[model samples]
Target: MTLDPRLNAFRPDLADRRLEGQVEARHFVDGRPERVTVSSAALRREPRPDAAQETEALFGEDVLVFETTEEGWSWVQLQADSYVGWIASAALGPRGDGPTHLIAVPRTLLFPGPDIKLPPLMGLPMGALVTVTGEAEDRNARYGLTTPTGAVVTQHLAPFGGAADNFVTVAEQFLGVPYLWGGKTTLGIDCSGLVQVALAMAGIAAPRDTDMQERALGTRLAGIEPLRRGDLVFWKGHVGIMLDGQILLHANAHHMMTAREPLSEAIARTAARGSAVTSIRRLG
Candidate 1:
C-alpha cells in the first residue's frame, strides 16, 4: 500500500499502514517539550545514522517532538525555523527554560572552570542559545559566563533579542569554515546553514533549506535589478549571500570552504552545471 506523501512516517504518520483502532491523527503533547542538549545536533531526513542530514539544531533550542522511535531517534521539528526532521534521541533532553543569551562570536570555548587554563567543557557556535546563571570577573579575563556545567567567556555572549548588526558582517566571519553537508556551526556549514545562522544572528528567522528559504524570505528581484549586500541569491539546490552586487559569499563543496567570489563567476559556473540562478531576493 502506498502512503500519502504528507502522511509519510517522517510527517505525522508513524507507519505505512494504519492499525486497527488507530485514528491516524497527528497529535502534539504540549507537556513534553524537548530541547537540543548537545553543542550542535544533527537533524536528519530519516531516523538512522546513515540518513541524510537536513539541518543542525543549536544547543538549548526548543524542538517539537512528534514521536520517539524504538531505535533511539525522535521525529522533531525545530522551533526556531520550523524545519521538521529526525534527530538522535540522546541529543535532546527536557526543555530548557528561559534562554536569555545567544552566542555572538564565531565560536567560544566552554571551560570547566572560570580559569582559561583549565580544559574546555565544550565549544558553542554563534547563534547557539544559552542561559547565564551567573557571571565572573577575573584579572585575566574581563568577563566570564557561569553556565550550569561550566563557564564561557562573556565577551562572546550577547543578550538575546537585541538589535542585530549587518547580515553580511555576520556571514563573513565564516569565510574559511569548511563545508559540511548538514552543518550549521563554525566547525563546518552548508549553503543554507550559512545563510540561516547569519540571518538568525541578525534577528531574522529563516527556513532550513534552499527551497524553503526561497519561499519564505525577502522580495524577489527581477533579472534586471542589481544585487546588493545582504541580498540572497539562489540556484536550484544551492544558495549564497551577496557580499555586494559583485561578490557572492557561500559555503560550497567546490571550494570545500566558505568563499567570496565574483557573482559573474558563480553565474557562469552554475550555468555550466545546469543550476543557474533561479532567484535573487533582497531583505531589509
Candidate 2:
C-alpha cells in the first residue's frame, strides 16, 4: 500500500499531518489552503528554479501548502488533480471565495479595466479560474469584471460546473499548439496535459499522466472492436485521442506540436520505433 508521492505531500523530513500513521516522517503539520495567483506557475520536482518542471498551477486553482522555504518555494498539492510538487511562494495567495467561472476558450486577455482598448494586464489560458463580480459593456463587447480589478471578455468564460458537450471538440481547439514536455497551457502542452485539460472542460476529472490515465479512465476496449471518436489510444509512454475511426489527434514530439493524422500512420510509426498500441479505451 505505497502512497504515490505525486498525490501525497511527504518527504524524508516532513509530511502532511493527514498521513500521520500511514507514513513515517520527522515531523508532520496540517497544511494551509492557498490559491494560485499568477497566470501559470511551474510546479517543479525540486525547489530550485532550474529544477525540472513537472506541471503547472493555473491562475485561481486552489492548493494545500504543506511547507514554505526561505528560498521562496512552497511544497503543495493541487486540489484539481491532486498532483504534488514545489511551486514558487509568490504564485500563491490566501484562498478567498471559490471561483465563479473558468476561461472556456484557448486563451483570453485580461484587461486592466472594462475597456478592451486599454492594454491588457495578462492573457489567461483555458481552465484558469476567476471570480466574476459583475458585468460591463463597452461599445459592443461585453466584459466580466473580476475580483479586485481586471476585465475579461464575457463570452470567453463559462460558469463553474458548466461542461462542454464534447471534450474531443475542446481538445481539437488546441491543434497546432506547440508540444512541451511539462506544459499544460495553450502556449505549449504535452499529451497527458492535453487530455487532462480537455476532459476537465467536459466535467471529467482525469489524472495527470498517461500511466495514471490509462489505469483510471473509462473502460478498456477489446482489440477487435471498432474505434470511434473520443476513444483514447495508448502506447508504452504516449497517448492520443481518436478524432474518428481513422484519425488520431495528439501533441507529440514527432510533430513538435498538436497534430492530427490517420491512426494507421501513427500505429506504423510507433511500431517502427518498437512500440505498439497497448490499449484503446472508450469513455463511458
- Considering every candidate listed, which one attains the maximal lDDT? 2
Candidate lDDT scores, in order, read: 0.81, 0.94
Candidate 1 regions exceeding 4 Å error are 1-12, 15-31
**Model 2 per-residue lDDT tens digits across residues 1-284:** 99999999899899999999999999999889999988999999999999998988899999999999999999999999999999999999998778899999999999988998999888899999999999999896899999858999899999999999999999999999999888899999999999999999999999999999999999999889999999999997799999999999999999999999999999999999999998999999
lDDT, candidate 1, at 277: 87
Cα RMSD of all models vs. native, in order, equals: 4.0, 0.9
Question: Whose TM-score is greatest here?
Answer: 2
**Per-residue lDDT of candidate 1, residues 188-221 (tens digit):** 8999999988988888888777887898899999
In candidate 1, how many clashes are counted?
A: 0
Per-model TM-score on C-alpha atoms: 0.89, 0.98
Model 1's TM-score against the true structure:
0.89
Error of 2 at 33 (Å): 0.9
* 213: Cα error in model 1, Å: 1.3
